[model samples]
Target chain A: MVVASRKAAYHHKDGEMTETLVKKNMSASRTSAVPNYRGQQVELGRETVGNVRCANPFMVAENVNVFYGDNHAIKDVTLEIGKKEVIALIGPSGCGKSTFLRCLNRMNDSIESARVTGNISLDGGDIYDKTLDPVVLRARVGMVFQKPNPFPKSIYDNVAYGPRIHGLAGDRAELDDIVHRSLERAGLLKEVKDRLDDPGTSLSGGQQQRLCIARTIAVNPEVILMDEPCSALDPIATARIEDLMDELCEDYAIVIVTHSMQQAARVSRRVAYFHLGYLVEVDDTDKVFTNPHHKLTEDYITGRIG
Target chain B: MPNQMTSRARVEAGLSRRKRKEKIFRASGLLATAIGILFLGIFFSTLVAKGASAFVQTYLLLDVELTAETIAPGGELDLEYADFDGLVRTALRNNFPELSGRNDRRELNRLLSVGAGFQVRDLVVANPDLIGTTQEIWVPAASNVDMLMKGNIDATVDESLRNLSDRQIRWIDTLDQAGRVDLRLNKALFTNGDSREPELAGIRGAMMGSFFMLVVTIALAFPVGVAAAIYLEEFAPKNRWSDLVEVNINNLAAVPSIVFGLLGLAVFINWMGLPRSAPLVGGLVLALLTLPVIIIASRAAIKAVPPSIREAALGLGASKMQVVFHHVMPLAMPGMLTGAIIGMSRALGESAPLLMIGMIAFIVDVPGGFTDPATALPVQIYLWADSPERAFAERTSAAIIVLLAFLLLMNLAAVILRRRMERRW
Candidate 1:
């Protein structure tokens, strides 16, 4: 009966199941005669709910785990990021969401004691292959930090930093064009075009964050990873960045780690919820919010547990 | 309410006691500062009072007949073998025609400096026509006469106690009355080299030695120190070996500089077979002493650069080398330069290491190259201070003043460079 009920809820398709309905379903499963759901015995944190695979995946991780000197930072996890899609990884603090995000671009290699096991691939290429340089990989998968860190250089140089380093531009005019287009796409050209010579640090916090975004996009990476890019911004700036993610997703896959559920709901097509280093559930944004299949995902979304 | 009132009164009492304690602490700090300033003021005042006399030297004008027979005896205009001292003696005897006895004539001739002959030679060499005519020449007086004229010697004291005898004082008075005695700027103090006669001794030789050593020291230490700091801070693995190196570097910074002097003596002088008393050897020794300081300071400067900058560069696909050279290095350069300047200044004031490398030897000629034999300013000052001559005491203070000035200028440059670099950022 519980399996049938969960199957019914999974195929509900309404996309607007009320919080009471999710709670009623959870309570009914607890009291039901059948002790199984989805043809398996139910467990809160052991198994992930919903689908982990995507229709057209480009970046894939399989049973990936991360350890920092024997401290399990990220547990056995699997997820796929597709081309031209926005995926949000959301969890409470210390849940390893950011760690998992770093794993995609092999950024975890910088940490001395961090050890990653299992497989992660981008476009069927093993990124951890000894022959593949991390420098080249980072150019393909760029990251925006939680804080805006513009170089101690002019706005133009900050935007030109990636292109110059990667030899992406062949000449001065080409570099200038790249910088101009990046700033324009980041929605900062009108504000900073007249003062490209000004130090990037001289900008307002929101503008500096936008300048960092411009810097990231100047390299034209295949995927852009943003780790709580809006956490340091005010609500208006956060809205601006959320709108930018919407527009940016059309050209490249974007993975965002955020603490704001509303942000995940607004920006991402799919939402992955992590709890205690475990990815509890990943599903379509509406399903994860309105009709979560896992008890922990439902409880977390309903403010019952973090 | 009664309990609350007591508690408030107790709090007020404790606050008054804390304020009293703070006042006492502040007064103590002020007192310490005042004491330090007082000592510094006394030191500078004494230095100026003693060293000011060295800037001006006493000269005696003499009408000397530079006979061609005495200067170019063979009519070949020979300058090196000229009897310049005989010409000076004849001029002195002409001035005092009354002194006929051999002892009286000898005492009168002693009034002129031994360098007076060299001065006359230089004048004649510059103007060959002066060799045949009698001309009025202003010659530096002997150190004793200079001391008496500068009031360093007490004429009121008995002849036995004074540096200048009664007869010499009388002669100087007669010259003063005739308007032949004058005080002029001591150009010799800057132009000439060390001499047995105090009036001929100058600091140019030691100054050149110090300059050459400092040049070599900074050239060797700055690049090596900065490179080591970069590697240890940016690329070195955090393991047992790196940890040991870090500890050893910290220890090396605290090592007494004299130990480095000993090491330089054993290595550069004994094993390497480099010439002793050469500025090159002194510079090598000082570089050893300064390297630890520069490395430690450079590491601190490199560490002070925010990690976010490194990450920003790294995130942009910059290689580790590119990140360090293009980003981290530029951001850390101002700090590194400041550290290097400070290290160079410390090396400048360092005399202990140079002393062990035989730089304490009394060198007479200014160093023209790194390998030439030389002495440093501090060693010259030390030698002068140990001299019995009253004039050397003044020169010692003057050398100290020059050293202090250079130190002040270097520190000022460091401050200005730091301010400018920080503003650029």
Candidate 2:
């Protein structure tokens, strides 16, 4: 009885930390949401959207909702993914974390039954706009799936597929360079450089995941969406990928979906907790893990509910 | 441990029971094999017994004096003296001298193939140098003579009932003794092409026509079918209309090939005014027949390519068109080709529809274009099978053998291509 009670007490203490964290992050965002009249007044003469601090907030999703047939897969969720920040979405299965991640690059548009509403913008331009080509949007907003889905092609060809398709490289030599650089960034070049002609599937599961990441990076996307990218990996591989994610955050804005609470806290600069297709709370990673406002977020973080 | 032991015992018991069942199954399998072999044995024996004699042919060797007086007037190579029937009669009289005194020379002439004149004409044309030179020519005899050589005819039958007289039989016997009658195997029967003369007709022209038709079929059906399949399977919106189209495509594959032939006749022949008896028309009809097969196969192949591939391509920023053509098309090509060849093989053997579209025409020259007059092997077989001549029976069987050989070759090529090219993800 004492052990069970002690476990409950530990859960409760964790809950209090999450609550305080949510309050602080939301407060800072609330102030930033308002018009910057004080900055305009301080300006010498010229003022424009560029002069504003929020001019290029990396990614801004406003009232995003997704439906698949009759099921409401995602509710109206509003969030801002700041430049070079690692934002992790933590949720139980089918809670729309992956759905929301796909919406970042309009990947859901490929699904015939899926219908997305509202604006999801990368650097202020609406990504879901009628004029925007999904192909170009996807090139700029790269994605990595849950499973290590390296194409049944050579490692070099796998990484080069994106650059070749988008005509990102100037020539074959340039494409080879892009492939090498991308693989190096993904931390797989050293291991696979000698066997570049080998099939992508010939690699280990963790290596295949990194290969997929390299393939995504070949297009030089400004943002990366990782949907449980490290789930189909071992502890060693997972740790390596997490470290890579931290380094990737310096150059590209990243949104990751993870089931592991520790992974969410360790990797992400900011964390969003989702429950039943709703974004329950969003805050800085440390604060969200330490203190949350929403009761559901508290329950999930403390292992009381999911 | 208890559960493991219990499971192990159960597995052993199950294995014993399975062993017993397998024994029974093997016994029944052997019985089925025996039955199959028995049936096959009967079928093959019947076929060989009935068709074996058809392979052998009889030839009449005649030592004729090729005098310039008979062949050409004024000792010149006159094309006018190339009267085929006159030359054949002169040769026949030279072989059987007893027939020279016979009153019923017309009856004696009937023993020789009515179309023997054509063979003689061909020989003269081929060797205009052979004029005025005495040569022993071994020419094909009539089918009745072939049957006689094979011992299928008896001489001791009733005088009134028999077509040939005892004296004519004596003449044939004397000619056989004098080495003037040559009853050798006829290889020309299989290698030659269609002719009005039953003795000289072969399936060569029809075989080439079928090949050309199948070529056109592959060229036409493969691209259109696979493209349509890719659009339907990968790119097209999955709405009610596409669903309806999918269902309709499935139904079209099941529709009788004859119906497609009728449709081709109406649309390709009457409506488009395509040349009748041309391989082009035949090919078009066959392609229409083959299209649905190829489409269904290609769709299945495209579907067999896992959705993960499409997602991966899309994730990599490849457009929908690129995803289909670059990845899906290569994967689906083998199945499409296999299906196309199978469909074309079926088309090769199709006769009823080709007959309705005037593919049964007795053509001698090889087809030059899609619009050229031609007959397919099966259509040639059909035409020969319908003829009242006794000799046409063997010709029809020979045509079937050729058609079967072509179909087998096509199927083998399909198998080889599929094995070599088809890649499993």
Candidate 3:
């Protein structure tokens, strides 16, 4: 019991050092929230918009910011994602929700003008460390985009893409099993089992999105990030995807960005709300919908302001 | 009621005017398309009418007895030493029994082709038993007689300006009346070499030269252009240096083709010391001329591939190289090939650059290799077009038709490939 208590003390001390570091890095503009806070400057103690830590996190983003040339796209954002949980990021348009989601796997590296600056770690390893490669990092943390961008290939090939590139399968038979298992887990086996050779694009929109989900999990990533996976989909398709996400969170840590307030409450245990480029609030899904702590979060969930 | 009627009449008048304008616009569009088709039809028909005669040429029939005296000097059949030209003159003399003056004999000899002797000689050599017998065979008529037999040279024209003399025309008429003159398909037009005699010239050498040059040009341009396009479009940063490259590439496309010729002359000829009229140098020059065109086209093709595909590949943990090669390039391939076809056709039609590279040498033999002395079809037509012979004009039009056919075939391939490979999504 002494060793455990002392270890907790050491963790708190480390947390204090990180808090001081966060204070030191905050520019003058980030010290206070906007005047919608009744013209009162909120205290900057430990400087968090919401509950930003957990007992053991699968991924941690500390004091992260993103810029595009002169545009500060994301500002001083800090969040931690726990394993076996579905966390939904919710916000108005252009509030850097998708930007932060991409930061998890370094998908922003492909954008020419995007510049991300912060401490981001997966399983306590710095993802931005010069020794780490983004390609391998991405295998550990997969992503699903807004559209069902199934590759211009067969459904089998689409699911097998990650396996082929990383050499996860030793032979064609093994590869087929991974594809079949991934499709089964994505809840698409009943429909697509008979025509695995058909193009992924030949399926309906919902089927195509499920194919993308199957492709992502086939790589066996520890965490999955979906960027508004249901925006282009209909109501029925969106509900199906939400159901898939709930089932998937049993095995993998899931972070999803969505515009719908009800989708966050329905699918995720925790919700993160962003305003402009600022991350405003993060709390339990019930607490955020009923008793948001920040004024911007209240204004947004109440439908008064964004 | 009167005011309502006036307003209704005005609105109806306005509506009728707009509808009439729409119909006029549609009719004008149809008329413009018809005019373009009419011009194409007129051009094609004119070319066919002018060049169809060149496929067949006039020939003269003569009877000759190959005596042992002419075939052999010492009673032994010596085929190599035979006096075939003597036998030809003898046959003409025996047929007409004309005046024996040297001038008259020369005029009669001019009625037959210089190739007539070789025709009789080859026949006799092929069948040695016919040496002591008389046989009637048709050999090519002289170019002037050929023109007269084909009705290309008008007898109504003044005798001074016409290449054929009055007596030569009369002999041709007599031969025609006797059924001794015939128009056989001009196999020589395909089999022979470039000649001072337009009747003997053929495009085989030029066609072969063009084939070699085009092979070299495509081999050099297609890969280099695609690689450069991939580098510029996918990898190059948006900086001043990249901007300069982009500007220069666009500028190079508008640079006159003759400038590329001068560049080839300075670089490939003066500095490199390549053979002047060789298809190798001409092909290299053409490759340089087409590189800019291909690069511009390939860049557009690469650009036309959607960005969502790249994002999808990247989201799947694909490396940048995999994203480009596996997804982007396959999607963009059909467009790249279309661009390549357009650039190559442009190279095929280019004559000025090859001319500047010195492909204007008077070539005789078909190009046996890339480095041999050669001329392309356009250069051949250029050379033939400058000739004083009336027959070369027909050959010039024929070469144009052949060039158009080659371009048409490449365009058809581009269309077929696009249809086969194009994906709707």
Candidate 4:
């Protein structure tokens, strides 16, 4: 938490008078048995979500803020997603975790009223610049939605959409190979080996999610964004998708937004906790779950408040 | 739980009452459906009964001694001087030797159609040997005589009110008894074009007109309507201008068909110099009539494509155009085709706009092309309906069967297309 140290040092130099004031207000509010965070002026951490940093980062998001028309949905949050790592963004519903994840790939651009102000870079090249097309950016950085939305096409075409769109495959054999490799990586090849001509919607929920994962990776993207990819699935299906996510991390940096704390602890190497449109705390997954650095993070992890 | 239980008799009564109500509801529903089917059955049965006679024709047998004097009056086969009409008259006279006066002979001559003379002329021109020797031949009886033979006319009615004289009916009955008159299935009814002689008229010209007109209408309206719908539903930004266009399209669908005919008359015929009664103009007018319906249907179909599909395609780097054409359009096709079928059925049965565009013209030649002067099936029906001939009334019903058949085939094609192309997501 480098931001926390810089803010702490600045606050320590200026806190001689306000420290006494804060202490007096803290005692005054505590007399009522409910701590008044506003009156006591509790210090907040300016750290990135998941304080773990990589020496070679694939993508870095800086000072990302999002607004939906009149509503401020995401605050200034900075985070770096490392290559070949699984980072889970866990928070209660409407806490800007999904919004922050959407901002990473400029998925926010689809909403007419959504306004995003941020600097997101892939290999240090600005993704928001006018010259780079969104079509190309999305090809390099793919996303999987919570509800599986397979195109009204055959199973083979679903995995082949990305490669076909980008013209990544040279011929039918190459395209078939890409589809095979993608489905194999998603762990869906064996069950669907014979029925690739069947509709993609014919799959079970977990299988559909895996198919979506296969579709995303068929483009060979460097980063994969998953917005609660297993939320619509059963526990068993959810576990299978989680396992698939674990395997996918070896090839691509993945940012997943999840509601399950146990899922974050089990699958992600790092976890970032969000609250009220702010990045409250981030650290190693075990540290954030067992001993959070921020009071909000601790409340969320222990089920005291969400 | 024991206290909550109803008495056995009361429970049985309640159950029976509910069952009775359901039975009444089902009976009423069945009765409604049966009434509709009964009406359709009566209409089709009556139509088939009346129109069945139009498919058969009656012929009169004639014998004549043809020599050089009757055919080639000057030595060579001279069609201009050939006494084909006189030869037919002499043949009728020979059949009824009791006929003496010119008035009686003229009444007897009326039994043969005016076209009989042309048949003889053609026979002599084709083979002069036929003119030099007597040969028995069967020629189409006059329309009234044909109707009398077919039992279409009331023989008991007085001769003054009927189209035939008592003597003429006697001659027809005698010919029938002697097996000299025959009722054969009229292949000419399917092959020939409109004629003042009702016995010779057929629906071929009208069927061709309808085919050409529908081709033009569908070719013009389907793609344009679908494109307009895609732009309006998927690409158009929300604003007053687009809203106005949408409102106008809805309004256009409700306008009278005859008004489109008027538009075709004024614009396509007068301003554009297109031929009146041409299927090209009539089809353009019908396309105008159908375009809004197609657009409205296509828009609903496009809207039926789920937003999730759009998001999924976009999420995978598919462009907006790809999302629409590759995903949205295919998903929406069955519904769009269903709408187009509805519009085409309406167009197939439409007559008012065709009338306004002069499609009620009595086209004599089967339409060779779209620009030829033509009459669609329904307009042909209208023209036949207004004619005073009894055979035309039967022919009108026949034309209705043809129109309805075309509509059915079109609807079946649409259903097949939908079933073949439909994609379930």
TM-score of each: 0.91, 0.82, 0.89, 0.85
Tens-digit lDDT string for candidate 4 (B1-425): 56556576678779988999999999999999999999999999999998887888887778866777767777788876777878877876787888898899888888887767776776777887675788787777788998887777888998788999888899877777878888877766788788888877888898899889989989998999999999998888878999999999999999999999888999999899999899999889989999999999999999989888988888888888998998899899898888888888888889998888788987799999999999988888888899998778888888888787888888898889889988777
Q: List the residue pairs that clash in candidate 2.
A: A17-A290, A17-A291, A18-A290, A18-A291, A18-A292, A19-A291, A19-A292, A20-A291, A21-A291
Chain A TM-score of each candidate structure, as shown: 0.85, 0.81, 0.87, 0.84
**What does the lDDT read for residue A14 in candidate 2?**
33
Candidate 1 residue-wise lDDT, A51-79, digit = tens = 88999999998877676654556666889
* Candidate 4 residue-wise lDDT at B228: 97
| lDDT comparison, 2 vs 3, better candidate | 3
Query: All candidates: CA RMSD in angstroms?
Result: 8.3, 10.1, 7.3, 7.6
True contacts kept of each: 0.61, 0.63, 0.59, 0.78
Cα lDDT of model 3 by residue, A36-87, tens digit = 3343444333344668786568899987878665456787888999988899
Assess the local accuracy of residue A76 in candidate 3 as a C-alpha lDDT between 0 and 100: 84
Given candidate 3, what's the lDDT at residue A117?
82
Worst 10 residues of 1 chain A by lDDT: A33-42
Model 4 chain B worst lDDT run, 10 consecutive residues: B1-10
Pick by DockQ: 2 or 3, better one: 3
Tell me the spans in candidate 1 whose CA falls farther than 4 Å from its real position.
A1-43, A304-306, B1-13, B73-76, B423-425
Model 2 scores what on Cα lDDT? Answer: 0.77
* Rank list by lDDT: 1, 3, 4, 2
What are the candidates' individual DockQ scores? 0.44, 0.47, 0.52, 0.60
Backbone clashes (count) for model 3:
0
Worst 10 contiguous positions by lDDT, candidate 2 chain B? B95-104
Give lDDT tens digits, candidate 2, residues A1-306.
Answer: 213323433555533323243233333332222111122211111111111123348888876767675455665677888898888998778789999999998778888878777677888799878898899999998999999888778999999999998988899899989999999999999999999999898999899899999999889999999999888899999998999998898899999999998899889978887765657678778877777665556657886323
lDDT, candidate 3, residue A162? Answer: 93
